[model samples]
Target chain A: MKHIKVFKTTMIASVVMSGLSVSSASQAANWLMLQGTEPAAAAGRAKVWGFIQAQYQKDQSDAGPTPSGEGYIPPKLIGPNLNSQQQFNVNRARLGVRGIGMPLDSRVNYFLLAEFGNNGITAPGGGDAHLTDASITINTDATRIRAGLFKIPGPEETLQAIHVFDYINFSEVSNQLMLERFPQSVDTFQGATDTPDASMGQYSRALGAVRDVGVQLFDSFQSADWDHSYAVMLGNGNGLNFGDNDDNLDTYLYWSSEMQFGGKGPRAEGLKLFAWNHSGKRTNAYNKTQEQDRKRSGVGVKYLQKPFRATFEYMQGDGMIFQGQHRPTMVFNDEEADGYYVDFGYYIPNTNWELDLRIDSYTRGENFIHPVNATLNSAASDESTFDKTTIGAQYHINKKTRINMEYSDRSFESDTATVNAQLEGVGARMAVQLTHIF
Target chain B: MKKFLMIMACLLSFSIQASPDSKPFAEKRIVLQISDPDPFKQTLVLNVANNLINHYGQDKVDIEIVAFGPGLRLLFRENANVDRIDGLTNSGVQFSACENTIKGMTKQLGHAPQLNPSAVHVSAGVVRIIDLVGEGYQLIKP
Candidate 1:
């Protein structure tokens, strides 16, 4: 009942926010100065910008039979899979103010963005007004320094803003592997607490949005036909919406080169190649003593030219979650994981239309092995693989408004403990969204 | 007491007249910053400009595109976006090239290169953006 009330409150807030006029006085440039004691400096300006995305999504999957046996399935694996569901809701309603305050003679740029679109969907930090970006960037001739809550320097798609996602949803591999594992309280693991609600495990896990509190240094060097860039970041590996959960800090490094193909200009108009690495340690919520080592590395390439673009990324990681989007059972040790995806998009010439297609594949070890006989490693019982194919279309009504429709077919390959051994099932989803920006 | 009342009335009237509803759309200013030289990103910038013009009518909106760093290539005569730039310029949009970047490029290319006829050279791109913001222009970097 309390959860329902919370949902109601969030819905009311969302409705109020949606009814707000885009040109309201609160969105005016002078509103910032008016709220503060500081005089309107000659170099300070604030611009309010954001977008609302309303979507209807539905997914249907065939579940193989449930596994039975006392020790064969861990306590954590006793519940039903939550991925087979259909939902309709506002996917995102984000509003933010970003501008230069001229604090360092305009060389220091600051941005603060928050989102209030978390009611209908189960996403990490999705249910309320949450910070998306709080960063102060200092730009210099040699390098740029950015610090605060920001997107981690990783895959191109992960770094891209959610408002500009090419499809209705992120690629399966990106959605599952690129983010930090969700933390679970010791009480929750022991079934000692009902507040988080055992059934809401998946939703709770969904809270780790792919952002971290960090500082990043980056710069770009360009030549006649190519541009090369590098960035180094240090972050608290914890998800956004909160402070660091542990004393350890995450480190990331990225390097990329973009080269123009046949273009006479120095601009990188055609091809892009990049590589990234992340190394860190994270506190295990269920067992404080087991502070886990986290590492991820990947390489990617992209071809961009006019009406056609293609991108491919391959990444591998060693962490708690294996073969799924959530953490593993305590009895099972976290294993090495790898995943990759390829995406292609084309815009219709002379029209506000576009088409997109993506294919993703991921494989990892099992989430549980009998605690007493943990060494029992069998390929038929300890591995899971997932593959997905998606195709979508988008229509741009105007610069600030867009409509997208997508269809996806997903399959899971697993060593099912089910009596029937029905390890293969296809899940399909159809989604449509309308986004308007102000 | 009469003088105090008179002063309050004048202040109220000024506040009412300064409201956004009383302001004309044509008086609004926007600055689009282009610092990345990626053609696709530059194309998105132009797309944003065209959309704003279409929505508000070119005459009702004052728009300026400020290019710096590698983004200066957008204003080159051989730029892939020159035609688009010409069309937007014809629609009353203004384009500014950073003088600092131009000087650096000239030094590197060993010649004083040419820019599109519509592009006006500014002393410095960041400083130009700051000045424009001081004048109430909304800055958008895409």
Candidate 2:
């Protein structure tokens, strides 16, 4: 019924943004913002944070019978594949307002933030989370500037940082080159639409997106433990759809740097390195006859001590376009696609412990693109080439609860009508999480 | 009396360095404006800008946080909301972006966030919030 009244108006705007960040219903001597077993470094001040997570899942599918047509070709769908052990849930509820301020004056100091999440379980605005980020930051004596809603500078294993995720996703030909570094439409928190029913993940964004609006620029230069950084961006070519078309554009650019080889904390922090670049184009077109193009590049590296966590990544993709003035028989071929991955993890080195182990692999070649653009190909049943493999786990019972797990195995080497139109089987997924922090 | 016990040990180390909430007045100057993206709200806005930079210190209170929308992934450099711009760009945290993001080059389709300009480009965002409330700053929003 109108998508359940747009999921009751995005769950009443997330219970009025968690009651405007607490402080209500007078009664219960409180001043909450608690939950921390460790992850300290309050370092310097302006604080208001939060957290919450929940999950459950299990799956399997192959439609009975073994080998119902060899080359029955089945693999790389990039969308839809779930429902085997239902009760799937994932959450991240938040509110923000950081500290320290002086707008390029008073010698320098700065920060600002905001967030909200929930994108799973029967989906629709209840998987509704909005306002991905709102920023403000500055550092002097070496230079820096990081505007708002940023970070989509071309997949280098997605720039690592999900508390540092190495596996749980890999193979599917390395997630189609890390799903072209975030950007999607629809999954509305169940509100506002001229067009949008579904299609958010398989890349990024879900239920109310605009993940990283636009604006970014960077600079970092450090020695005495080693650190280097470089960046670039010029967003809003409609990557988060705000439409009203005016030369239609979506821009983002990036360059990375990391170094700390050994000598920080937690058994000597190990190693790091990263690099990236990405490009896009589509500009103005509604009466059909629209044009498109893209480019992506990559590099990655990381390592940690103690429980041994490792990572490696490589990426390459160029000029990926679609719609030549209205499906001229659906084209494919701009040429150039590359991807790679590696992972390692173990944690018995507990103290306030959290543990994880991992594995991943990637590959490419299925009508790849980037040949100075124009003319596409792949689907003479999908011209063969794709790969995948994954295994993962995470456990932290205290300090705000957590328990996660995953297992995946996929393979495809098509051609001949894409082995009869892909979807080879061997999939299983699971989850369990409960988190709290304020 | 040994100079009154060294002035009562310098008034007990200046009342233990102004413990908790004891700032009668002098200490209120802010300048923060970021754009969003969500990495746990960029670590909950860097844990409230590390307690307002330790309740005002980075030189007797003065800070700056100006990033463009999508909150520039803490200064994106391959950031898919991952490196958090190297976990908060070397501590001192200060950045600025927005040249309408990056002029134009097409092929977006969607998921915008991720801008980097090497730093500083205050050409918009409502003219830098009316020039930081007319250079008096004190506006705070993450």
Task: Estimate TM-scores for all models.
Answer: 0.62, 0.25
Chain B TM-score, structure 2: 0.29
Candidate 1's residue-wise lDDT over A188-239, tens digit each?
3321111212333432543446677888887555565565667898988876
The sequence of per-residue lDDT tens digits that candidate 2 reaches over residues B49-70 is 6677667654444445665655
Per residue, candidate 2 scores C-alpha lDDT tens digits across A42-83 of 122445665655545444433323343221111211122221
Best by TM-score: 1
Candidate 2 lDDT at A426 equals 31
List the candidate 1 regions with Cα displacement exceeding 4 Å: A1-44, A65-84, A119-127, A186-206, A260-269, A322-333, A369-381, A416-423, B1-142
- lDDT for residue A119 in candidate 2, whole number 0-100: 44
lDDT of prediction 2: 0.42
| Model 2 segments more than 4 A misplaced | A1-99, A103-149, A152-163, A167-234, A237-246, A250-290, A293-365, A368-379, A383-385, A390-412, A416-438, B1-142
